[model samples]
Target: MQLMHKGSALVTDQDIGENPSVIEHAKRMGLRLITFGPHCNAQVREMGFHNGNLQIGMGSLRLGISLQSDGHHMALNAQAALAALHALGYAPAQVQASLAHWQPMIGAGQPQLLPSGICLLDHSLSNHLLSMTAAFSQLQSVAPHVSRRLIVLAGIQPGQASIDAAQLALEPLVRDAQARRVLLYGEPLRPLAAALGDLLHVNWYDDLNQLICSLLRTTHKGDTVLLAGRATTNLALAADAIRDSFSGHGGHLIASIQAPCFDPHQKQMNMHS
Candidate 1:
């Protein structure tokens, strides 16, 4: 693809697999090419969680990238961008400053904090297994001490394969987070209830209203609730209902939804004020 900057144009491969064609084309055009690979010279020195943000130490420059998840690809993308910037004479300090304001797109890696002290991680936009697993691992580290750890999984569609995959992805989070109660909704999640049988409190509901009712009744103060799964109309409705139920309860309700980064949809979480 062509990148235009200051009357100069640069071309690069779309992915690592297309490097051969990109290199050949560059050679034919007498143009210089800069490439990055899986095992590139630039590397991430260390990565950790600090104050709900990801701290990445790269080649003597430390940058804090904000997100609720691990962001496995994001680190690599940053490395490539830094390499390009370095070639263009940008200092490592300048690059670090630019990344200070880098925010994750909504439903991708954005994390929202409700007034009730609940943190919502929205990964509904892209739930690739690896990404989801990374996100949960980060969550496990930053999760605060609370009375109960609750997980709500919405419905998946297109058949049993998707359901099975989601279950496998979530099992580790359930185990690691020590989720005390899990609420499963929709037909696709029926099988999951049996799979997790007797491990913890598993409540299966065919109707969203029933699930919300159970959640409202069972949840107590200082509980951390995580809502994940496919975004459906019913799931949205249920999320709203649960958020409303926490209005005057003086507790947190974390809800994840699918939306673009700039989408302007906001609702009240607490009404006791």
Candidate 2:
């Protein structure tokens, strides 16, 4: 998930749990990295990074850049995409969106691909907070059976101490618990889960390895997991490690929503390797 900025050499570090040394290399290239979780440094929040977007903090005169962020209307696009896909075939029973490192995920492979052109492209500030709000009503439409499907979210936020942005997404995600079954799990989940509820929350880290292992064992092809937050690198690497741990017995264990979107043609992220 490490992408060098297009014009100049500015690579923003998106994950906080990654090796600091590699991030230093990115810095040497004139790229700035941003962290979006509690484990991040104070300086990261000072720069305007939290959820999934990383604003290059390096002194600029730069041109066309390679920036990676999935905040704001990005959720809108997922919502629209889900709706369209539902009408098509994928018929995702439920849709949940959040900024707790887990964002909404769109699966490929045998996913019952929906129509295209329904992605969110706006990365504006004004558009970020309201992204979740706009989709809230849409989230309310699921039937009881459809709500049984759990939609998880994970990603960095756009601002610091992310209460506003988090709530923006949370308000809608938890609106339906009986039918939709929204689960909120994260490192700092006690307060959030209490404020939100078990049906809508859980302290994520409490059973991280176990939970991931369980998911790896039971998750099907059409199901998706959106991993965001912390440093993009750390989360990505963690996912990599988790996948590797399950390598060999079954088919590919990790199916990410990362881009270049993950060319299934290659069947792996490190295509260069």
lDDT of each: 0.54, 0.33
Model 2 vs. true fold: TM: 0.32
Worst 10 residues of 2 by lDDT: 108-117
Give stretches of model 1 more than 4 Å off. 1-40, 43-98, 144-147, 155-169, 232-273
List, residue by residue over 1-273, the lDDT tens digit for candidate 2. Answer: 355652232222234325677566656666544332223341222233334443222223111211222443343333333333433344233322222234333221011111221121111112233443333322233213442233333332546656535544554344443323332334433344455543432323333433344334433333332233334213343344333433333234343323222234422111112
Per-candidate Cα RMSD to the true structure, in Å, reads 9.4, 19.3
| Residues 237-266, model 1: lDDT tens digits | 554544555554423343322222124442
- Best candidate per lDDT, number? 1
- TM-score against truth, every candidate: 0.59, 0.32
Clashes (backbone N, CA, C under 3 Å), per candidate, total 0, 26
Where model 2 places Cα greater than 4 Å from the true spot, the runs are 1-148, 155-171, 177-185, 198-203, 217-273
